[model samples]
Every structure is written in structure tokens, then in C-alpha cells.
Target: MIRTKSFLSLLLLTALLSLQLTTRAEDGYRLWQRYDQLPSKNHLKQYRQSLGEVMVQGSSPTLTVVKEELQTALGGLLGQPVTITENSRKKEILVAGTPASSALIKGLNLEADLQKVGKEGYVLVSKKAGGKKYTVIAANTDLGVLYGSFHLLRLLQTQQDISNLQVSNSPKVQHRILNHWDNLDRTVERGYAGFSLWDWHKLPQYIDQRYLDYARANASIGINGTVLTNVNANSLVLTPDYLRKVKALADTFRPYGIRVYLTARFSSPIEIGKLKTADPLNPEVIAWWKNKVDEIYRYIPDFGGFLVKANSEGQPGPQNYNRSHADGANLLAQALAPKGGIVMWRAFVYDNNVPEDRAKQAYTEFKPLDGTFKQNVMVQVKNGAIDFQPREPFHPLFGAMPKTPLMMEFQITQEYLGQGTNLAYLAPMFKETLAADTYANGKGSTVAKVIDGSLHNYSLTGMAGVSNIGNDRNWTSHPFGQANWYAFGRLAWDHSLTSEEIAEEWIKMTFSHDPGFVAQVKNMMMGSRETVVNYMTPLGLHHIMGWDHHYGPGPWIKDKPRADWTSVYYHRATEKGIGFDRTKTGSNALAQYAPDIQAQWGNPATCPEEFLLWFHHLPWDYKTKSGRTLWNELCYRYSGGVDSVRAMQKTWNTQQGKVDKERFKQVQMLLTMQEQDAKMWRDACLLYFQTFSKRPIPQELEKPANTLEYYMSLDPKFVPGI
Candidate 1:
């Protein structure tokens, strides 16, 4: 009898211990929604007093979510369950809803405030009603109330004072979206994270909790749309099988005000419609597309629209049919226009057959067809002219296409920024492109203004981020990668917010609010992008990564499928000089930009040192802004990149006890690998370029660990995301 009792006790003890371990583990699954107990007793007391009772008005899916979120967040942060009531007897009560839904809110005379912020915008204010202090979150629609609820929760999570909370908020961009480059096979393209999140085979029947959480996270940051498929689209996704799965996701996301979009394979007509050709002008093809689009709307009524990648990187488009890109886009637009859906046509086209400057080709192709696109069509342009390099000038197409709506496309995945290993905060890089003076409408015309519809006054504007999220326990493989996702959504909502402001907000909500820790981490994040550029592709150097996988240094890469795909074609290194001459002497790509931009970047002497090599090819003996010869400058920049990695390692080491044990160790190990990778980049690039410069390595810098032949011989196999 005693043995039986003891055995039962042992089992119970083990169960209890397992539960305890699960509760304490900081595996980063919560992301920025970590509503931990407030550290300050006084602050907690004040918050509890102000949010003692919640009276959310209306009965809708979104309003219910808002109430539940407030209850959960407030309960977690204040260390007490908040009372939810229809009528508040307490002095301070939280009231939230659209004016139509709440009689009290409508009587509050907030029409002027509602007018200021449109359909998706919200107003949060502290008011006195019937001698009772009430915190009211009001908007014209339920979606806005949901957004305001998140804003209120964010304020409390970040330990900000909410007493004088009179704030009106709305997304600057009409459509803020995350483009998941996830394939039907569950593989993500250029994705460093694990396999895709959508389990297509099981999605319609079985909805994972992660899907709901993903919607919640996106909605919290004001993201209203998500493209669930890859741009290199498969026609199968448009079929009924995939549409059912998509409907399930859309149903899940609808409560969060997020609509789902899919990439439209231009050749779907031939591939799936049983048609012979996908000619945009062909009547049969046009009819087939209209029928297909109508079928999609039947399943997903609130579908955002289509994102098309045509005649670029082997994707089929109207170009194959001798038609313009506008023809291809308008064909799809015509079908979706009646359904209130839009078309996001990608401007990443490059024709290796033409042999023009790869950077200039996008501008050449899209600039001429600017005013020709349909009203629902938005040309999605990458931040830079080239593929997502470590650094590049803003795409000249931003301001040049005045009659068309241009959407900004940013890669949140670290494909070129050291993939999943290095911690590269991308907000600084994004801010750099946004802040660049496009000069499309004289001096004050910025890229941000062009895309925000202020510069061109286009009614439709949007921003799309290539999502880095995946099946990893932490959505992004790297823990710090969460910040990039967070940063992108925040910036997409409001480009006016500084990188430092965003970084600080992320740090406080994700980690500790300790001023010392926040300051140190913010500095690290702010400088991380520049550190990556310095180490990977400094001083106008671009697209020199390894062949195919783009993992490591491959300055010697040559003889690829296309001449432009080769590293030698971009760098153009010779015994006399290193760097591509894009001036009047060579490709004359400089003339594509505004004359003011041309004047600034056209002359190597007057150009910013960061883009020196990008615009002009210089000799080894040429002098730079740093007062060093071209060879020495190259060596310094490469070495400096390695040194910066070392500094990051040291900075992270000091934060050992400041962050959680799981994340701290993970980041620490990743930083060590980053240091090693930085060294390889420095050595491999310097050694290869030295062969052309015919110069000796700087004596002060560390010597190469391995020979040029050894570095060249080392090849990584089965690299992920191939």
C-alpha cells in the first residue's frame, strides 16, 4: 500500500515539475506580446487603478477580440484580472468601440476626431462622463477600435504613462502587408528560417494556434494584408483545393482586419485554364482569367489582390507575347477591378539578352509604361534597383513614375545580410532608402513621400515586406530577427518614426525596460546594418556573394548562366582599377536619375564615399575621402567590417545576465559565428581583389588565415533555402 502511494506521488511530482519548466522557459514564442508583470510597484498600482473596469461596446468578432485582448494584457501587466462590465460603476473605466456601436461614444461629440482619422484610424482619449473618469477608444469602424486597443496595451506594456492619453493613430500607407515567399511544398524561397508555416494539406480542416497568433501580431502593428504564396507562383494555388485552405486563413485573419492576397502566375491560363496561350490581348485568355478571379472571390470575398512577377528571372509574362508589362498587369487588373481587388506588378525585371546595366533595366522598362497601368495596379519596386544587396541606392522608379502608384518592397529575410546567422537590424537600411532625396519634384521630394502618395498624389499606396517568419519556435530563426519584422510593420505604418524610436519600443516590449539595457541594445541595433555593409559589401561594392546560394565571398565568381549573374561583371576588377564605371564612359546609368542626383553621384570626387565604386571605377593609386589610396581603403573597409563584428561580440557579452539565458546564449553563439564569417569575408575578398590590385595587405591588419586557393576550394554543400 505504501509503495503504491509513493509511486503515485512520484508521478504527480514529475507532472508539476514539467508544468513549472514550461511556464518559465523564454523560448521567444510570445514575441513582442510578452505582457509580463510590471517591474515598478507604483506604476502597476497606478495602472490597476486607471484600468479597474473595462466596458467595451458592440458585439462583433473584432470587438470581442479587443475586449479579450484588453482583459488578458491588463490582467497580465497589472497582476490582477480586470472586471468586464456593460455599465461601469467605478470611477475609471476603459470604454472602446466605434461611435455607431456605442451610444455613449456617439454622444461624446467625436465626429470631428473621427473625420481626422479615416476608416482604419482610431482616437483614444481620457474623458469625464457622469462624474466618472473614462478612457475611451473611439473610431468610425470596428477595425479602428481593435487597433486602438492594441495601442493602449502597448502603452501599458512599455510602462508609459497613460493618464494624458489623447492620441489619434492611423496607418500612413493604405495597405501594409507581409509577403510570405512560402511555397505550396512548405519551402520558403530565400528564407533562412525553417520550413513554411502554412500546412496546406491540413490547413482548411485543422487551424493551428500559430495562425491566430500570426494574425494577432500583424494586426497589433497595423498590418492589414498578407500575401500567403511566393511571387514565383504555382498555378495550383489558384485551384479550389488551395482556395479552400486560403479561405480558412482569411476567416482566421478577418477578426484582426487582415486580408489575404496571392501571387498570380501569369502563365496560369496555359497551365491551369486549358488554354493554348497566355496572351494578355487574347479574348480567350482574358475570359479565362476573369472566370478564375471570380472563382477566387467566391471563396475569399475580401481578397486584397494579385502580386505578379513576370518576365523576370524566367517567370513568364506578356513580354513573351510581345506585349508591354502594362498589358500583363491590366489583364489581371481588369478581372480583379470589379471585385475591388488590386494588382501589385513587380518592377524587378532584368533581360540578360539586352546586356544593359542590370540596375538601369528596371527603370527603363517601367518608366515608359508609367501612366498606362490601370487604376487598381500598383508597381511594387524594391528599395534598391538591384536585388536586395547589403546596400544600394534607392530605386529611381519611385518618383519617376508619377502617374502610377509605387509600392515599396523590403526583404525582412536576411538573404544577403548574412542569412540567419548575423544580427542585422534592417530599420537603418530601410530608413536610408526612405530618407533618400529622390528630387523627383525638386529638393524636398523624398522616396518616403513618393511612396506615401504625397509626392505624386496617387490615391493608392502600399508597402510590402518579404516575410522572414517560418515554423521555427521563434517565428524568425534568429531571435533578433523578430525586431526586423517588428520594425518593418512599424515603419510601414508610419515612416516618420525614427529607427532609434522603433528600436527602443521593441527592446522595452521584448526585453527589459531597464534604461541601461535599452540604451546599449538600441546602439547595437542602430549600428548593425552599417556594420554588415562595411563587412559584406562596403564602399559601393555589391552582389559579390557566393554563386547560387549567396552564402560567402565569391568575388572570383565568373562564367555563370548569365554574364550579369557573375561577380566579375559587377566589380569589373582589373590590374589598373576595381569598380564598375556607370558614368558617361561606361553604362551611363547615372543619367537615369534626376540631374541633381546625377550631379551628386555622377562625379566620383563629389560623390559620397559609400557609393564611390558603384558609380565610378578607380585605380589602385586613386585617393578616397578617408585620405587612403583605393587599395588601402578597400583593405580598411573589409578589415573594419570584421572588427565591427568583434565589437558586436564584446557588446553582446556584456549583456549576458541582462537578457534571458536561452536567447543570450543563442545570440552569443551566433555572434561568434558572425565574427568567423566576417573574417572569411575580409580575407577572401581582400585576397581576390589583391590579385587585381597587385598590392600588399596592410601590415597593421591581420593576415589571411588560409591561402587564396584554400578559400576558393572550400565549398559549402546543401546550404538551406536553395
Candidate 2:
């Protein structure tokens, strides 16, 4: 009797502790939509009064979700159950819907407003009608109403005054999407967080709640499309069995206005259809693709389309038969066009075998084929000429491909920027690329204008982010990585939003609305990308990371299979100088850009110091704009990066009690790791580069803890995201 009584007590105690831990822990699964409660009771009272009764005025799948989301969010935020009300003529009722669904919304005459914001946009206003004031969320479509609901919730979450709300908004770009690099085997390529989110074997039968939550989070941020597979795709996904599974996901996400896309393997005809050649010009190949697409549409009526990676990185392409990238892309485009689907053909191709600079290859291949692509095809270009580096000049393809709709492909994954462990907020990096002056048509031709279809007047426009999401409980491994994902969606919707503004908004919604916490965290996030660059690859240094894993500094890396894959090809850090020469005297990569830019950047003296070593090979003793020798500036930048990280640690440590203990401690520990890593990057790169520069470390900077030989000898195994 005593033993049984003791067991029962222990069980009861365990359950209570579990409940408390769950309730108290902020694991970041909710992402930026963490709507726990208003910080101030007076603020909560005002919100409750403004949102007296909630009414999403429709019965469609999308509006139903809108209702449920509002109910849950409002209930948690207000500390009471949301009341929709039984009264027919209630005043101050928060209503949301399209004009066709509600007579009250129709009577408000929102035609002009609705037309201005477009089909996917909404008008949120507070109006007086029939001696009653009502806060209305009106749009022309149910999806728009859903978007408005999220925006209103954001206002509430951030504790803004919504009593006199008048907001009109729309996504700047069409087809705002996420490109997951997840493969069929449940392993994500360059996925630092965990396994793939899609459980292929169990997917069609059992729908994970994570799928629903994922769609909800994306819908809240106006991301409408998701390419489900890796760009280096497998043909098995095109099989009938997998199509059924994809259909299940499509059905689940349809309610939240998120369409599903898949990456089409170029050799599907050869692999899946048993054809001899996967040539784009082959009739059998063409017919096979058409039939496969037809079958996919039967399963998923609203399939977005395909993202293709061909003729790059050993991927099969039409080039096997001497056809251009356009031919390979058009093969898929022809099949998708009739169904109102589009092809996002990637422009990340490079024939590294060519005796030319890698940065110039993509432009040479795609520039001449600008007007040749099918109208339904969008040429997806990376932000930088090289891979997702810490910083690089904007791709020459952006403004150059005016006749074709160029889609911006930004990496939200931190593959090149410390992966999952480091706290590197990427909004500043994204904004830097977006704000680059392309000088395509004139001085005002920014990359943002070219992408949103304002520069060249292309009919179709899109922006794709390489998703950092994984099956981790936090979605993204690092808690702050969620901020990068949030920033990508926010900027994809509106490029005009400043990075600082996005950081502030994310901080307020995700962590705390307290002025000091938000301000301090925002400041830290705003400078994080620069700090990482300063430490890792400052002043035009590029692609010097460790071989295969790219985890640590590998400035001595050479003799890789391809010359471009080696650090030696980019930096060219000889005994006399350090930096690549891409000027007229060297590879002439500058010729790909506009004449104005070429004239400015081609000359080493005129180039911005940030890109000084990128375009010009300078001697170690060359005087920088700051009057320091090139070697000293490089040393200072590396040390400054380490110092900035320590400052961020100090900033984060002061907020221990301001947020949840779980997330606070999580960030604190991660910051410590970051500080240590920053030191490693500084020491390794400076020590190795010093061997060539033959310069002493500055008096103020800390000396490296180990010799260059010791640093070179150390090779970390089991690096994630290889």
C-alpha cells in the first residue's frame, strides 16, 4: 500500500512539472506569431474594447481558417474567450471578408480601395455605418481577408493602437515563394536544423499538425508558393505514388492560400520514362513531360510549377545535346504554360572548366538568352555572382535580363554564414543586395525595381528564398534564424521596408515589446551580418571556407578537383599581394556590368573598399582609404568582427530576465559559442594571410593562440550541413 501510494504521487508530480515547463518555455515553435498576452493590462483593455466581438464574414476554407486563427490568437492575447456575438446589429464588431460574402462589407463601397490593393491585397479601416462604428477588413478575395487578419493580429501582437486603423497593403512581387532544398530520403541538403519536414512514407495517410502550422505561418507573411523538393531533384517524386502524397500536402495548404511546387529533375524522361535521351528537342521527351504534368494537375489542380537546376554542378541538362539553357528551361515551360503554371529556371550555372572568372560565367550564359525564354519562364538569379557569400557585388544578370522576368533568389539558410549555430540576422545582407544600383536603364535602376517588374515591365514577377526550415521544434535551429525567415517573407512582400524596421518589428512580436529590449535587440540584429562578414570575409574576401563543409577558415585550401572550388582561385593571395583581379588587366569580369559601374569599380582607387579586393589585386602595402596598409586594414576588420560579437554578447546578457528564461539562456549560450567562433575565424584567417603579407599583427589586436601549422592541422569531423 505504501509503495503504490508513492508511485501515484510521483506520477502526479511529473505531470504537473511537465505542464509548467511547457507553459513557461518559449521554444520558438510559434515563430514571430507568438501571441501570448499583452504586456500592459491597460493596453489589453484598449484592445479588447476595439475588438469587442470578432466576425470573419465568410464560410470558405480560407475564411474558416481566418476565423480559427483569430479565435485562438485573440483568446490568448485578451485572457478570455473570443465572443463573435449573437446580436445582429452589434457596434464596433471587427469584421473581415470580401465584398461578395458580406452585404455590410459590400455596402461600404470599397471598390476603389479594393482595386488599388489588387486581388491578394486588403483594406483595413475603422468606419461609421448606420450610427455604429465598425473596424472592417475588406478585400476582393478571401485570401486577402486572411492576410488582413494576420496584419491586424500583428498590430495587436506588437501592441499598436488599432482603434483608428486605416491600412492598405499588397505584396510588391507576385509568386512570393520558398524553395526547400529537401530531398526524398528525408535529408535536407545544407539543412543545419534537422531532418526534412515532409515525412514521405507517412505523408499521404497522416497529416502532421506541423504542415498546417507551416502553412499558417507562411500565409501570415504573404508567402503563397513553396517548391517542395531540392533543385538537385530525384525522378521518383514524379512517380504516381509520390504524386498522391504531394496532393495531400497541396490539399492541406490550399486552405491557407499556399500552393505547392516541385523541383523537376531534368533527366526525368531518361530516368522515369525509360527514354533514350533527355534532350529538350526530343519529341518523346516533350510528350512525356506534358503527360507527367497533366497527371500532376489531376492530383493537384493548383500546382504552382517547376524549379529547374540544369547544366550546373553535374546536373544533366539540354547542353548534353548542345542546346542552350533556354532550350532546357523551355522544355518544362512549354508543358506548364498551358496549365497557367510557370517555370523558375535557375541562373546559378557556371562552366567552371572555362578559363574565365566564375563570377562572370552566369552573366555570359544568360545575358544573350534574355528575350529567348518563354513568357511563363522566370529566370531565378542569386543575389550575388558567386554562391551565397557573406557579401558580394549584385549579379550582373539582374538588370541585364530586362525582357525576361528575373526572380530574386535569396538564401535564408545560413550555409555560407555560419549555418545553424551562429546568430547572424540576414536582413541587412538581403537589403544590401536589393538596394544595389544596377544602372541598367539609368541611375535609378536598383535591383529591387528590376525584380518587382517596375524597371523592365515584365509581366510575371517573383522572389524565392532558400528556406532554412527543418523538423526541429523551433523550425529553424537558432531562435534568431526565425527572424531571417521572417525578414525574407517581409522583404519579398515589400522591398521598401528597411532592414532596421523589419528587425524592430520581429523583435517586438517574437521576444518582447519593452522599448529597451526591442531597441537593443534590433540594434544587435541590424549589425550582425556586418559583424560576421568583418570576422569571416571582410573587404572582398570570398569562398575561403573549409573544403566540403565550409565550417571554418581554410585560406590554405587548394588543389581541389576544380580550380574555382579552391580558395586560391578567388583570393590569389600571392607573396606580393592578396585579392582577385577582375579588371580589364585581369579577367575583365567588370565588362559584364554597366559602363558607369565598370568605370567606377574597374579602377582600384575608385572602388568601394568593401569590394576593393573583389575587383582588384592589390599589394600588401597598398594604402587603403583609411590610410592603413591593405594588410593592417584586413587585420583590423578581422579583430573588429570579434569585438562586435562580444558587444552583442554583452547586449544579450543584459536581457536575461526581460524574456523567457529558456530562450534567454539559449541565446546566451549561442552568443558564447559565436564569440568563440569569431575568435577562431579571426585567428585562422589573419594568421594564414599573414604568411603571405609577412606583416606583424597590429599592436592592439590579440595574437593568434596557435601557429598557422596548428590551425591547418586541425580538421573538424562531423560538421553539420555538409
Candidate 3:
């Protein structure tokens, strides 16, 4: 009896401790939604005085999100109770709206101009109204008001002065989506975070607070769309049972202006509708898709349309029906057109039968069908021609597809780059790809302009990132991974925002507002992506991760089914030299680029060192402008990456007291892990590549402690998304 009582006491204590630790994990699943206490007491007090009472004059599902979010965020930041009053005659009040719902806003002459701002745009102004000075956040619709509410809170959270603020904001791109490669069974493809947040089994019955929180987080960043299932799809999602579950999530996210998208299995007509041939040109197949889409829209009126992965990597597509990609994409676009939906057709296609370079496949496949796609169809191209490698030249399709709308697809999940274990800030990489000159129209044709439709004059434009989100307490598995999510949103909303600005904003919102802390952390964040690229894929080397798992080095990967699929095919390092030659003399892939870019990159001496190995195959003895031979420069770059990571570690250590203990420690541990992995990458790559160079390691750098073979053998078998 005595022992039983002691055991019960111990169990209770353990549960309480677990709960406390969970509350303090600082893992980042809450993302920017942390709503942490404001660092400036004066600013906090000032904001509280001006925005203490949130007078929500309207009630809608979206307004509910706004009110609840305001109350929760304000209470956390102010450390005081905040009330949502029905009456707004009080001195200090926050009036939010649509004119129909908010009389005070209507009286302010906002309704006349609200129509111009549209449903998702907002106008926030500080003015004198009805004998009292008040801050007003108004919009044409409740969704816009909700967005405005979050925008106002964001400014306050970052400790910015709102005394004379007059801000009008709308997304540059209409669709900002996070593509979840989640299976119905809750397994996420290439996901390093926890299990899928969409608990399909329990959802549509029990609406988890996690779902609400997910909507809030996405809304805060202006990510207005989410595709909840894997692009490598299953047809069952079109069934009535799954449609009910999808509607529940759509209803929850509606107020936040987030629409749910689903992956449409091309073979669904055959599988679910009992049709023999699921051909895009087939009248029966086309008719079946129309009916299915009609059913989906009936359930989810604001349903974001289908994302299709056809005839690629074993999934069924247009090729099975002897139809072009346009045929497959347009059929669905036609179906969803009446409902005002759009089709996002994936351009990630390759086949074992095609003996051409894997990097050339996507460009070849989509180049011919440039103007063939319907107006509502967007051809989604991966950031690189190949899969999401650590470093890849911007896809050739970015420049080649001038007549069609092409959406940029970036992977935020770190599938090939270190997953959740390695600390890699991806903003620099994103900026690099976006800023690359595609040179389609002229010298200034950049990938950013292409996706934003400035270069091609496309009406339908978007940017999609494969999400890293899951059920982890911090959202993304690694704490720093949140920065990628934040960066993607900032870039998606305004591609013009620099990486430095994005990093600083994220640092202030996620960590500390102290000037020194922000400055120091921003430097680390800016350099982190390049550091990973250098250690992992320096000098334009690409796709060398272990087969399947893709965790660590696999420079020796060969003997795969397809020659192009092997890592050895890309690097092409032998006794003579390295790099795949894509120049006019070689594959003539250089012809795809505008002549000016071709002139700059075609010549080895003038080509940027960052992409030298991508376009040119230089001899080991070739002298670089750095006064180092090609081989020595490669070794130096690999070592430099490791050194940069160490510098990031030192900088983070100095920031210990400035950030919360739990979060600081979490980042420190991740950085420490990064150091070890960076070294592993530096050593293994140099040692393996050195065998072909037959050169000595730079004397100043430390040599690998282990043999090349030993490093190859010491593999972590548990790497996810293999």
C-alpha cells in the first residue's frame, strides 16, 4: 500500500514535468505563432493602451480566427487580460471589418474604396473618427479583415511603432501554397518533422486545436493554400468519405483565406470509377473527371483545384494515353474552370526509355507544349532540372517556357540536403535560384521575374514549396527549419525581398528583437545556406546523396538501373577531370539559354566560379583567378564550408543569454550536429574526389582522420525519406 502510493506520486510528477517541457520545447512547431512576450516593456504598454480592447463588430468563421488570435496574441505579449467588446465607443479600440459588418468602418468612408482592395487585400490606417482618434483595420471581406488583424499584430510583435501607420498590403502572387506529400495513413514523404498533422482517422469528427493553429500560422505568412496529400497520389481521396474529411479542414481554414488542394490521381477513373481506360483524350475518362470535380466543388465551394504528377516516376499520366502533357492538364483545367479553379500540372518528368541527360528531360518535354496549356493551367517546374539537389543550375524550362505560365517548385523539407538533422538555412539558396538570369527575353530575364509573370506576362503565377511541417511541437522538426518556412512565404509574397531582410524579420519574430542579436543571427542565417551548398555540393557538383535515403555521401553510387539515375553520371570524375559538359560542343544544352548568358557561361575563364563545374569541365592543373589550381580550389571550398559552420556556432554561443534558454539550447545542439555532419561531408567528398584528382590536400587544412572507404562504410541506416 505504501509503495503503490509512492508510485502514483512519481507518475504524477513525471506527467507534470513532461507537460512543462512540452510547453517549453522551443522546437518551433508554433512557428512565428509563438506570441512570446514583447522585449520592450514601453512598446508593449503602448500597444496595450492603443489596442487593449478588440471590438470585433462582425462574426464569421474567419472573424472568429481573428478575434481569438488577437485575444491570445495580445494577452501573451501584454501579460494582461484583453477583452473583445461589442461596443466600440471606448477611447482605446481596435475596429476590424467588412463595411456590412462594421458600422464604424462604414462611417469612415472605407466601403467605397474597399472594393478596389479586393477580398484578400487590406488597408490599415490610424485616423480620427467620430470625435475620437482610433486605429482602423478594414477590408472588403471578413477574410481580408482577418489578414489585416494578423498584419497589425505582426507589426506590434516586432516592436514597431504604430503611431502614424498607414499600410496597404496585398499578395503579389495570388496563390502561396505548401504542398504536403502526406499519405492517407499519415506518413509524410520526405518529411523530417513528425507524423502528418492531418489525422485523417480522427478528423472531420474531432477538430484538433493543432488544425486551427496550423491555419493561423499559414495565414500569418500569407500562405493562402495547402495541398494536403502527396502529389504521387492515391485515387481514394476523391471518394465521398475522404471528401467529407477534406471539407472539415477547408471549413476550418476558410476564415484565414487558406484553401485546401488535393492531388488528383490520373488513374482514378480506372481505379474508382470502374473505367477500363483512363486516357485524357477518352470521352469517358474526361467525363468521369468532370463529374468527380463537380462532386468535390459541391462539398468544398472554395476548393483549390488539383495538383497532378503524370507519367513520371511510375505514376500514370498522359503518355499512357499517347497524349501530350497539355492534353492531360487541360482536361482537368476545363473541368475546374466553371468553379473558378486552376490546375497545377507538375513538369517533373523522366523515363528510363529516354537515353538523354536527366537534366535535359524536363526542358525537352515541356518546351514544345509551351503555348498549348489552357489559361488556368500552370506547369509546375522543380527549382532544378533534376530533383531537389543541394545545388543545381536553375531549370532550363524557366527561360524556355515564355508562352505558358510556369510555377517554381522548391523543396523545403530538405530531402537531399540533410533532412532535419543538419542546420541549413535555405534563404540564400532560394535567392540564388530566383536571382539567376534565365536570359530568355534579354540579359535581365531572371527566374523570379519568370515565376512572378513579369518576364512572360502570365496571368496565372505561383510559387510552391514542399512543406516540412508535421505534428512536431515546434511544427518543423528542427528549430531552425522554421526560417525556411518563413523565408518561402516572404519570397512568395514579394520576390523582391532580399535574403538579409527576410532573415532579419524572422530573427526578430522568432528569437530576439535586440539589435545586436538580430544583426549577429542574420549574418549566420545569410551564410548558412551557402555553407551547406559548399560542404555538400560545392563548385556545382550535384545529386550525390546515398540512394533512396539520400542522407550522406554516395559519390561511388553506380550500377543503378538507369545510368542517368546514378550519381557517377553527373560528376563524371575520372583520372582526366570532372563535371558534365553541357556546352555547345557537348550536349548543345547551352543552346537553350539566351545567347548572352551562353557567351558568359560557355567560356571557362569568364564563368562564375560558383557554377564553373556546372558548365565547364576543367583540367586539374587549370589555374583559377584565385591563384589556385582547379583541384586545390575545390578542396579549399569544401574546407571553407566547415569553417563557416564553426563560425555560426561561435556566433550562436554568444547569443545564449539573449534568446530563451530552451530555444537557444535547441539551436546550439543543432549547430553542433551540423559541425559534425559538415566535417563528414567535407572529408568524404574531398577524399573520394581526391582519388581522381591524384592531388595532395591543401597543407593548411586538416586531413580526414578516416579512410575514404571507412567513411563510405559508416552509414546511418535510419535516414528518413530514403
lDDT of 2 by residue, 198-246 (tens): 9999979999999999999999888999999999999999999999999
- List candidate 2 stretches off by more than 4 Å: 1-23, 85-87
Against the reference, the lDDT scores of all candidates come to 0.91, 0.91, 0.86
What lDDT does model 1 reach? 0.91
**Comparing 2 and 3 by lDDT, which wins?**
2
lDDT of 3 by residue, 1-722 (tens): 99999999999999989666434545555677667677688898788888888887877888877889889998888778889876866776777877888878888886555766776889988878767777888988888888788888888878889888788877777789999999998888899988899999987898999998888888888899999999999999999999999999999888888999999999999999999998888999889999999999999999999999999999998889798999999999999999999999999999989876777888888999999999999999999888988888788899788899999899999998789977788988888899999878877899999999989899998999999998888888788899999889888987888988788778888877889999988888778878988888888788887777887778888999888778898888988888878897677676677788788889988878777877777788888889999899888988999999999999999986676678888888988988898888889989999999999998999898789998888767766553
Per-prediction tally of clashes: 0, 0, 6
Q: Number of the top candidate by lDDT? A: 1
| Cα RMSD, each candidate | 3.8, 4.1, 5.0
TM-score (all chains, Cα) for each model: 0.97, 0.96, 0.94
Cα TM-score of candidate 1: 0.97
Distance (Å) between predicted and true CA of 230, model 2? 0.6
- In model 1, the runs with Cα more than 4 Å from the true position are 1-23
Candidate 3: residue pairs that collide:
28-474, 29-474, 29-475, 62-255, 548-722, 549-722
Q: After superposing candidate 3, which stretches have Cα over 4 Å from the reference?
A: 1-27, 110-116
